[model samples]
Target chain A: MTRLAVAGVGAISPAGVGVSTLAEATTLGRCVAAGPISETNVAVLKKIRRSAAITLYAATAVEEALRDCGVSGFADCALISGVTNGALNFSADFHHTLVTEAKETASPTLFSESVLNAPAGNASIIFNIRGPVYSIIGGQSIAIKALMLAATLIETRRAQRAIVVCAEERNELSSFCYSRFNPKAARVFSEGAGALLIEPVDERRPINPVELCTITGYAAYTIPGSPHLALQRAIDGALSMADLEAADIGVAVSDYKTATLFREIPTLSFSDCLGYAFCVSTMWNIILAAMACGGGCPVNPLFAAGLKKYAKHSEINHVIIYAAEEDGDASAIILSRVGASS
Target chain B: MGIITSHGVGVEANWEKIKAGESSVGEITTFDASPYRGRLGAEIRCDTSAPVSHLRAGRLDRASHLLICAVREALGVAGLIKPGIDVFLSLGTTLGGMLSGEAFHREVIEKGISRARISKTLDYLAHYQAVNLFKEFALTGDYTVFSDACASSANAIGHAFGLIASGRYDVAIAGGYDTMSEFTFAGFNSLMAITPEICRPFDKNRTGLVLGEGVGILILEELDHAMRRNARVYCEITGYGVASDAYHMTSPDPDGKGAANAMAMALKDSGFPDIGYINAHGTATKYNDLMEARAITKVFSSGNNGGVDIPVSSIKPMIGHLLGAAGAVEAILSIMALVEGWLPPNINYVTPDPDCNLNIVTVGREAKIRALLSNSFGFGGSNAALIFGECR
Candidate 1:
């Protein structure tokens, strides 16, 4: 069982920048679009960002995460990011300008920022990170793939610490694709970014008593037509790896309807607050779950027909975050409060 | 191994073309390219996978079509079809489904955004192509897509190796795929990175790279699991390393520090036994080839003149730069070199400079290679190096 410690977390959500804004969104049940917030800041710093909003949002979130963790400069660190469409507006607009106008009139800057991994690349450039930098695109499981790769990097000793970022930028083509593919789940799509700083939990040394949280277990897989079965398998694998049971979990942050499989355990979610920002939604869920463990504040989670409110808590030592899609994509992660467990 | 490049549709066909030193680059016919300065590209004239498929070839993007055929060929050859064996899919792509995106954008440009057919744009997203792969084949395993420009597939394969090493999954499929798009063509042309002259690498008068498209995929199964099932193993993947330059988004660090670190790390990860050949990421650009030479000299210094004089070669001159798919394409070619006892020739070479002081394989050579190293660099300072050898 490989475990990684969460050192710090950052957010650039609809409410504002900072994890406090994410917590406030849960308290107020708010989901807003904060594209211009990151765009303005990133564009003021660099000219290329004006053409690419995803890079701007990702850099803004990564900056907060680096600062939150007290990491000013990079030495032996890696950056891994996840995105849904990766500056979709630029790609769409570039193609529009190329075909409508002459091919020679194409803007070089727009074409440079239109690639899929521009967000990760821009973040590495802004932060001066010299380690392994890459981005993952996992449809609805983008966050899952990013975190999984971070674990791989740490386990293989590729980097001592890693910053995992997941961002989304909404455009007309994105909205159209969402409406056509999964109409029921695509209620309201927004734009934002979520980041987490993770490091290897050194078991050789004494355990840090005040450690915020440790990712005990994680699993990602797919099932052809069985959505519920997919969710169950991921949760089962994660729990088994974490050496815990479903009943041992105090709370569960989930977005899938099949997550109801774990009944009567104070189930809740932050989608109402973060909206359906694809990968960002899952990243926010994980961050909020970490905050609830040791941040000295009880995050007020939003409830729905399936997603429940912050009901009575028993111990709140272990929180499991689960997300799934009807297209058979399911991923689950278990977070253990080190202070509480000790 | 499975591949669908301009040279051919399968591994054997591509290997024969590459082994014969036949360049596949020609004039672009899929779309009008006469307006651009660099009208030449490695476009596939005979697309067997796209023009006919059970996947409704008309609706799918060319990238998706290539990926579908490649995956089918790989899985079928490995006998993991139908009731698919439990496996993990790790894929890589840069401008995925950009041609489909152009089609949708053309509709938007001509009519209006609201009038554009939503179904036509469904495969425009990178993840949509991955999802279509799952739906087309009766695959049941999860997947992760890497998008680190030209190094996308190298990073994907590296992460897949880590998964197997950690005992998480027994079987994994790793590779990359891309299709020629006018958007990318114009972008490269706007940067003047595309050479109007013949595509060449590591030459004094070499112009630049010629953009191409294709898919290169390999199935990675655990040694014990494969032996238990009596699987036919071609070669073994020893190790891989990933690094970022962080100097420039469009260009690499002139000093080649990051590239050197990636190569050193990969060699270190593989225990540094002995390297026989290096498949260089020698893009014909003036800056790229020079930086790569400096990077190679930084790692394997030849001042002592007693080191393992390794031979270095670049296949880009023959196949054109496949961008995201270049890593896996080169990896597949390298493994063939290791197993088939023949090295793929780096054709179109004219002269060399004193700066790039290394053994450059100008023509095809036959040798019993013990181990091979392949490198890939991307537009955004992304760098990766992979090592392969016979099954240990």
Candidate 2:
């Protein structure tokens, strides 16, 4: 088994650019409203806006993440981007153009960006990452899938390090479809990007115990017609891999309501503060879990109350991240502090 | 392995057509392509009137149709469709259901957004295809969708290979599928990457690539797992490697560094001193062929077999470029050649360019190959190489 470490992190949520900003906002229990992205801090690529907002957001987050890590060269890094809508803006634009204008007159740039892999490709170009690049498409569970792939890549030695980025952009078509599918759950939809740099854990180097998190195990399952069952199965699979029980988990982060499964475990949710960001939701939760383990709190007030109760019993060591999409796809990941493994 | 291509459906049908050196590229009849500069493409002939009994009626796109047909054939061959067996599915595609999405968009525009069925909009999602497979087959296993431009399926296979080889999954269904759509066609045409004539890869007079669509499915099982099940292993996937040029979005590096690195990585992973054949990512474009040729020369110029010439051929001419599915399709053909003792010729190779100075196989030749390598480089400089060999 290969032990992996989270080297650096970055985020481009509604709150702002850096992970610190997101953590600060989350600690205050502030919910940032979705709006147009600010370009002031981002290093815009040429004609990047012509692509999808997902791609732009991913590029921004990746740049910030790399900068935060103080790693310059990416020749050996692999990029695994988890996406839900992919290029929703481009898809909508292309469709709008095709519907209103002739097929021949549709913008090729929009069509190019409309493909599911456009954001990964654009990020690869921006970062000069030559190692294997893959775009894993799914619902909210995609972020966990990306983490699993990153761990696999590192474990297999296919890549020295992997940059896993999950991003989703709000658009009319997706918003409309979500509203039509589930009205009550529609208001939580938001748009953002989160990036994490993961690599094989090196014991030789001096590492911060707080910043250090090991991806013990991950699991994904598809259960038709019952997302709750799928989530349970994934959690079970992950727990088996980590050789831990639900009671041993210090913090459980998820977009879905996990009170039924992880009853006594302290649960935290970023969607409460960040809203539901599709693919970005689970990743945001993961960043917060890492911060919390590193002695930082980004939980909402209600979740913070639960965290306070758990904090008295034990120091934050193990964090379990779970996410299930409406499509019945579910994924779970277990992250534990380096020296705090049970 | 199971395959559905423009030449026809099934592995044998496509193999026969490719062996005959026949070009499947023709006028685009799926839709009105007269408005585009390159109107020719290789399209699978599916009767829309007859629906697949298992799949949802009226909502299946051409890509999904091809995928379902291919998966059924593959599972039938593998005999792994029975319940209680856990499978990890990794599918690769550039556009999942753009055809259906396009239709939905047209309907929404003509009728109204409110009139547009939510099911139709859901069909537009890339993962919707995987979801359909999960429900249709009752696959209670992990699944992932890979969309890395033209290298999509190749990367999918690579990832799947890793999953199995790492003992993560006992079995996996890895392949790629894509449909030729007006959206993709117009985009390629605008980029001037589509050839008006049949694509002549590596030929001196080659212009550009011709669009094609199909699906290729490979049922991967661990050696011990297959042996225990008495499964007939067609070929062993020894190694796979993926890399990016980091050069440009749509163009390959002039030095072919990324392509060469991928091949090198695969070779190292395979622990094979030399490979007998290379299925080139020969799009027949000006830059791809040149870069791929250079990459090949860099890797195999000084072979361990004492300067032996490795046979190389591009099946893109016969099948056109399948885009996202091209990698898996070409990889299947390469494995077929390794098993059948013949080289798939590069048809339409009238003249050779000096830039591509390798030993290009213009005519089919008989050869007992031990190992073969297949290359696929896609838009955004994504490059992948897969190695397959006779099962030891």
Candidate 3:
């Protein structure tokens, strides 16, 4: 079996910003109705004015991620951040601000923070991570894909461990981009971030130490359904490769944008509570999956996420399943439990 | 590795034409060129008005057009365009459908949200390009869209190779595609990287680089996967190296430390005694030419931990330059050279610069090439090198 483990996780999500708050929110089924936060004067150096969403939430998640991973800083770790827009908060607004009113006093620090890998850069700057730092953006798959890449780096022994960070702001551009597709669901517009600390599942570590059950496989489909058949093929292929039957599978994470698609399966959507934060759904599912490992009591549909069916699958040491939808598209991954005496 | 390029579309056809030293860079036929100064590019000659099936799903931009065409041809050439195979798609592009934004700008100014926002739904936006292409190609496996400027495709191909090498994906389709757009043309022009006339790489009189258009893709499969199906293998992607200049966003360091490190790493990773031919990333820019020459010199002088010096050349001179797709296209040229014993020439290397003192195969030569190294450096100090060798 592939030896993989979740070393740490970071998120700048809607669940109050940090891991502790997010975990509390998830455990208590807390829901916070919020709106887009604007960083109008975000560029000042001594004045890093962030939307309440950014400071209150993202900061908390990042701290918890570092703390969990025993990463005091970026002192000697290879940091790979999945960042979509660099200093976008600064750059995106810079042009508009300059063109509209020419505010030379606007914060350049905010502009600097707009670098694509800001979160990783921030973590690096905060912790002094001095190894290879890379930032990549692939729509919503950023977090899951980053996890896979971190695994590759560890498996190759490129670095002892890789800190994977996925942070997104509730910027107007993101909301505008998403609202273009699902115009009717404008209220679904929410913002947050998520991150993970991945390291090699060392043999020296305790066996069954919260290991990665398995990442069945991933498939990407186009927006208009060119990959319907391809998606099924990937699912069947991964199942076959694992020498398991489709029915034998228990939990799955689907990148579902809407709840109607879960027509007849036990489904849970962290998106309902977190809102549509693009990549946040994928990272949030990590926590959901971890929580479900203890046989999550059927998802309560009290949450307006349209989760009517409790299509729970049979459990055979498999506790978590997840799926995330990106721009009317999705990628699903299934993770099982790593405990012994299964 | 499978071949799919704009020279003639497929491996056999491209190989045949490239052997004759023919130039396909010509007038832009995809769109009107009245507004632009340079209207030349090697566009894929394919009828895109086919069935609206898996291949034409989500990409509604020019870059997507190039990618879909290249991917279809590549999978067909590799005989891996069938069911039961996990198709992993990776593509690289410098400017993705920015032309669409130009259109959106006009629409927003003239028409308004009904038109401007409608255009935003198109996948040409940099962030959505890869997502749309994956959807269009119906590739439902591991994939990534690299945007590391010029080295984007090389970095992408390297990643795909690793996926296959690590026994993750059985078949990986990796390459790059870019279209001639006003945004990139103006941007590069603003940077003063574009030459007024034909780009003369490694020459004293060379002014700057010329931006070109095209898409090139390769199909990488596991050695056992290839042999088990009796499929023909062009070459094994032996060495892949990546580094960053960490210097300037646009200029390469004068000494070429980053470029040299990339070359040394590629050779070392391939574990080859000597690189038969190197498909140089000859952009012809002042700093790039000198830095690449310095890099080649350092690699040759060091002897690769005890190996011999190698021959190198750049096809960018003949085809202009494919920007984000240059590395993927040149890599195809390198792989083809190893397969057919043909080295593409650096057509416009008349006045050689003393700084660039390497065997550039100025007029294009032929030899039994067993291994080939392809170099690609991009803006933002990103550099990547790939080595392809015959499957042992």
Candidate 4:
């Protein structure tokens, strides 16, 4: 399989907007953990009609990515989004109106905004991207799925470029859901959006030859009662496909559930810096990995030590991002910068 | 193939009803529909609980029931319900267990927040609905759920096809499932997109779409793999093309450019195969049917793309719009029509609108359908076209 070029990256996290804030998360420390996004930071998001906070985050992040990519026209690009749940905030509001108030009072616009693919749709409309646009929802692997789908689109020539975005909005319904799904967990539910622009690379290009951001391997599986095994299998599959051993892995962005799965490899906890956002946090992990693959690895001492070896001479890079559920749902993906065979 | 639609519980029955050319829409009985202006829905009147064995069907949401029943039938048809069977499950839905969401909301509105039921929140998320299917069949594999409104399942099927084509997975079960819930019903009604009378696609006096609920599943296996297993081959998925209108949220592009592009792309993707028939997305809405007709004409007209005038029809008139499930179910019906060499009628179609310049299937007729196209246009400007051909 051919590698895909990481044209651009964008994110709107608790610390602030842009990928720079994400790169400085360790140094600046956490500013705000979790809450509703302030309008001042995302004032232009309202241009998209009848948008909820999730759509706002998504559209804003996508706009930043498009701007960062410096591409004026991406009319033929496809948009894929990874969402934890559709905009529960708007859905609950509509439901509340339907129940408390009359069903007649339920706003159709609000109802429209609640669907899972609303963000992708709104972004497509706002950006004039008439190409393929859809949403991916299944636990945490959606980020990997989104990236895989994007790479496939580019590889198959389905689209010249693909925009991969992920967003999660927290509300009362999410709070209730969190309590029900993971009652034992105490981390505050964080929320944000992330986007990446992926394009095909020229095979015969010179200069660095293989110094492009590329997703080398990805795997998804579910193994009941042996979630650890599922995680291990996913890692093994990704590593096997990428043809890299565990020793070559520079750094891993992992949740507590996946931290121990990386036995000897150095791991960075997502919650340590940005709290626990759902799909957006996963996208952030990929963005950091993408940066590292492009030889701009974050300088955090914890991740730097383990990642520095791969950064030396910048020849052949491998980084892993993993997520799992207690019920056996697990997914793993590896990104690398290929200069030579390791 | 497995299906449970307004017509009945099996593919043959559903196909028979479509061929019989009768409107199956009825007054909404599952919930009080008097509040909404359009009180009609193509509800599943049959016994949904009879098809369950793994989970307590009666205790589950109607979405789970429909999906599980359809999947059970699909597994049976595929001869893979036994041991050592592993296939990826990919599904699409506009609303997956929104009834569960309504239930949770009602509980919150009734009792205090502290007493809100936990069971109501189980299948509330769309992803959990897929997990429920895994639990029902005791199946364990990575699954993807696409929630792109109506095109949800079509996209799912296309994704699975891509993976299989890329040698990632050999066999995959893909489809769409949605249960008619008052939440969506009221929203459509509120938007004045639901019609009180029977849906009349391509008709001069078409009002709007009528909602329906059901599940449609198909086992997609590689040709060599299926041949090795000696599996029953239904039809070959030739091409799939997806596009977004980026025009309006509810309405399609006024000129049908997105829809036309999707159709043209599908035809091109299939190497410009001779498309003998088209299963239109025709939602029976004022905007959809006209736009679809123009789109079809734009692709298949004599003046455009060296294409021929293909026979087109909308099955929504007979079974009502299943929303997300419409893609898979309609594709299944298209496959049946292809193999059976029979064309389903576009029921309740009256005087044809002059704006729609094309051959509209007004009655069931015998035709040699070698290849066909199934179109599904979803909310938020999502458009997908799938091409299926006879297995030669």
Candidate 5:
């Protein structure tokens, strides 16, 4: 089993540009409405002006994460980005132009960014991550898969470190489709980007450092089976990988309604305030989980209160993050505070 | 392993056509191609009479149809159609259901938004193909969808190889597929990436690449598991390496360092002094062929046999470039070549450029190759190389 260290975290969410802003907003029990990242906020990267929102969000979050980690360059770092619709706005525009207008009128720039891997490719170009870059497409669980791939890459010595980013950009087409399918949940549509810097765990590194959280295990399961059963299996697999038990998990982070599974543990839902930004939801959960384990405030006040209430009496060493999609896909990862006993 | 290409709907069919040096590129029939500059493509000739048996059978897009058929063939060959097995699925695609999405959008434009179906719109997402497979086969294990342009499926296969090599899963069904769509065709045409005539890889007069549609699937099983079940072992995936150029979004590095690094990484991981054959990612584009040739020469210049005679060829001229499915299909063809002692030719090779100075296989050559390398580079500067060795 390869143990990976969460070295840094960054997010571009409804709360604003930084993770601290998100955490502060959650602490104050405020929900920032989802909107596009302003042009001024991303003007630092002038090249991004011609790029799509997904690329902009990813570049911003990745830059912040690199700075937060105090890393000067990422020449040897691998990138694994999870995207749901990629650049949907650009694609819709290009497609609409092709269908309604003349085929020759399709913007070449938009077509280039329309591909699903464009964001990951642009991120690699902008961040100077020359190592292997992979673009995974799925719903919420894709972020967990990205983390798993990152850990695997590090364990196999493919790279010394990895940057995993998940970004989503909401568009009218997507909003309309979702509303048509499930009107009740359409109001919660939002857009954001989240990133994590993970490196292999080293015994010589300082323990319990402020910039460290250890990801001990990860598990993913699909369905044709029951959703509950899939979730249980994933959780059990993660626990076994971590060599821990259900009772050992002190704080749980998930967008799923997991009250039945973790009845006694403090469960935090980042999506409660951030809305269901499918690609960013799970990564946000990981960030929030790390914060909770590090004794920092979360973006949700109720979750913050839960963390405080649980930590006052217990050590809150182990935090398990769970993410499930309506399609019956589930993923779980176990993170422990540095210096915590296995 | 199983494959379905424009040549036909089976591995043997494609191999036969490939051995005959027959080109599958023809006029596009899926849609009206009159408006596009490059009207030629390798489209799958689907039989409308025999339909796939599923709830959304008829509504499935070309990509999904190709994938489902290929998976069925792969599972049949591997004899693992039953459920309750821990078989992971990793699929790669570029367009997914864009054809269906385009049709739906056109309907929305003509009729109204209320008439557009949510299901059709949902199909546009790249992961929907994987979801369809999950439901179709009742796959309960982990699944991933890769959309890294032309390198997508190769990355999927590489990930599967890693998972099995790491002993995470005993079996994995991995491959890639994409269909010819007007969206992609127009995009490539607009970018002038599509060749108006036949694709000619490594040819001095080659213009560009020809888009194709097909699917390839491989059922990768652990050595012990396959032996216990007495399964047919095609070849062992010995090594995989992926890297980025970090240069340009669409163009490759001129010096070919990025591509060479990926090949070197794969070679190092495999610990193979020399490979018997190489399936080059010769996309027929001027820059791609030149860079790939340089990369190949740079990595294999000091060959184990004291000569840089590693026979290399690209099957793109025969089957056209399948984009996302190119890697997986070419990989399958490479494995077939290894087993059958046949070196697939780079058809339509007339004049060779001085830059691509390596030995190019112009005709079918019989050689018993122990190991082979397949390279796939895509639009995002993503590059992946895989080495397959004779399992015996």
Candidate 6:
């Protein structure tokens, strides 16, 4: 098991303002969702209205992540994020207000956030991480990919610790996007973010050690034939990472988007509790797996799949999370739970 | 990477025809440029006859088609593919598929622009023309679409290089693509960046730029990966340097200090004091050409040409300005020059500016070129320079 640790977290989601608010809401199964409202012209009002979009969710999550890490500065750390649609969620009302509200002498710092990498930029500014900041937008598999990247950062020893954040904000416009494609399903549009503070576990440091969940294995593939093939590959790859088999295990977290649910077999239990979350579903699954480990829930491996419409069933000694996009790109990461007493 | 020239779609076909020095610029076919000042532009030949398989797959957005054609050719030439290869697809594009959105908007406007029409248009905000390209490839890798105006793709390539060099990803596909959109065409027309006739870079009587569109992709891998896999190496990306002017959005720094700084940084990063050839970002604008020439002179001048006397050329006369895609395309051209040992001519260098005195490769010439540098400076004072040399 890799000795990677989640050192800190920050978040902004529909459930409320910060990570604490989101965690409290999640405990009650409260989703930050509202009926679609008519588009508004008030920029601030629009931000208030559609602020559930992943971009804003990501922004809030980023701020919280920095704060939770006690990172008052990004002066030395590299900033990297998994952004699915970037600032595309920011409405024209926001831009218009930004353009109109700027007096002749606009503050230089105001529009700096307008950059697509603003989430990382803001985090960098807040934390004073003067190193490198990177932002990449993969479809729904962005979160898993981010975790993979964070691991790579640790493996390379670029920094002792790095911040890896995955967030999606609610956008009123996204409804049209979903309606055009998956019209039958109730819009599972929820704006939320999940941020993890990742660091190397150092036995030398005299600090309260966070319980570690090791990332065992991961794989990503884009197939034109069977979208399900992606999930199968991830399952096989993740299991082999630990040199384990399908029956060795415990619980699972599946980050499969619901849009692809109709295309799969009806065995997974997600239909009962976790409906569909495009990207956040991955984090949701991880949260569930963590909960299962905490409450001694029966070990049922989470099987997540996307548009590739494939199912991945893993039997592991520890919890595992599966994440995939609809169009055939899928990734599976095995997490080894530590500290059974906890 | 992929090459989308008017003569043909793939590399072999383009190489066969480019030797003739044929001007691919002609009348605009995608849209009516009749009322426009610069009616001439480059267009890619689409092979619709080949059936595109896969559900919701074959429908290629204008930008996507260009990307597919180009990437396929590049991959074929590279002669290798691997699973578990993390990809960073970086592209610089603007107003992608907005032409389609405009078509949708026009129908609504004809019926009278209503609240419904307004919402529909705003929704297009999320559907940038480039996303269609990503969907077409089914690329599940981490990616980013940069919209830094003109110098967008250059920044994309530069950033991709940084990511790879910094050990973020072992392999990456970085490039740029832009199709002429009515929105961009009209906007540039309004801004007076479009020249009436052929663009004359660095010429005394040079006018503005002519707009063109195509896709360019560079399949970049870590140096070790290419060697181990025995992938055909076109050129090694030696140095990439980026700087912001914070000077102006539309205009470049007139003093050329920012441009000079970027080139110096690139050369310094490459650790190469000697530069062989340059693919100048000579857009032929009155100020751009003069400014770029001054910048080049300051960096390359050993005493006369500054300090380093090197041959320089701009292929914009052949392809016109591809805007967001220019950096990637120019970088491709630079790599090709290193590999092919031939310098493409500047084409329309009938007269030269007294202020710009470097050896412009006006005529296609053969040379033992190894290391080359290319420049792409975009709006908002964003400047990027990339140096590629024969893979050592």
| Best candidate according to TM-score | 5
Off by over 4 Å in 3: A14-18, A21-68, A71-139, A169-177, A184-187, A203-268, A287-321, A324-330, A333-342, B1-59, B117-120, B125-142, B204-206, B245-265, B302-309, B350-357
- Which 10 successive residues of model 1 chain A have the least lDDT summed? A300-309
When 3 and 5 are scored with TM-score, the better candidate is 5
Kindly give the stretch of ten consecutive residues in candidate 4 chain B with the minimal lDDT sum: B50-59
Error of 1 at B132 (Å): 2.6
Predicted model with the maximum DockQ: 5
i-RMSD of model 6 (Å, 1 decimal)? 8.1
Q: Which ten residues in a row have the lowest lDDT in candidate 2 chain B?
A: B46-55
On a 0 to 1 DockQ scale, where is model 4? 0.68
Give model 3's TM-score versus the native structure.
0.76
Stretches of model 4 off by over 4 angstroms after superposition? A39-43, A203-212, A256-260, A297-302, A305-316, A338-341, B50-59, B81-85, B304-308
Candidate 3 chain B: worst-modelled 10 consecutive residues by lDDT: B49-58
Measured as a fraction from 0 to 1, the native contacts recovered by model 3 come to 0.08
Considering DockQ, which of the candidate structures 2 and 3 is the better prediction for this target? 2
Fraction of true inter-chain Cα contacts (below 8 Å) kept per model? Answer: 0.81, 0.74, 0.08, 0.72, 0.72, 0.05
Comparison by TM-score, 4 against 5, better one: 5
lDDT at B302, model 1? 67
| Candidate 6 residue lDDT tens string, B159-227 | 778778876677778888777665555556645677888877777778878777777788888889889
| lDDT, residue A250, candidate 3 | 47
lDDT of 4 by residue, B1-392 (tens): 99999899999898888888977799999788887878898989998864655565655777887887898788899886554556688899887888888888888888966788767776777877687777667776678889989999888888888778888778888999888888899889878899988798889999999998899999899899988888899999989898889987777887898989888888888888888889999998899888888888877888754333788899987787888898999999999999999998888888878888778888899999889999999888999999999998
Of the two candidates 2 and 4, the one with more favorable lDDT, higher being better, is: 2
lDDT against true structure, model 5:
0.83
TM-score of each: 0.94, 0.96, 0.76, 0.95, 0.96, 0.68
How do the residues B1-392 of candidate 3 rate in per-residue lDDT, one tens digit apiece? 33334565565776676676666666666555434444455555654422345444443776665566666677676777665455667777765665565555445455655555654445544556666655565545556666667887887788788778777788888888777664455445546676767777888898887667777888888889889998978778988876556555467768887777777767777885467887889888899988988887887755554322566677765666887788888888788788878787777778867777777677667798877888998765667889998878
lDDT by residue for model 3 (A1-342), tens: 355556565554545545555555655667755435322112211222342233333444555666665645443355565544333344444434333443333344443343343444344434445443455566565666666666665565444666666656666554565578668766475666666665555532353223333333333333334334434444554455445555555445544534443344444555556666656667777655643442332231122132233334334344223333434333444454554222
Instruction: Give per-residue lDDT, candidate 5, residue B242.
Output: 87
- Of the candidates shown, which would achieve the greatest lDDT relative to the real structure? 5
Error of 6 at B53 (Å): 3.9
- For model 6 the local lDDT of residue B195 reads 83
lDDT of model number 1: 0.80
Candidate 2's TM-score reads 0.96
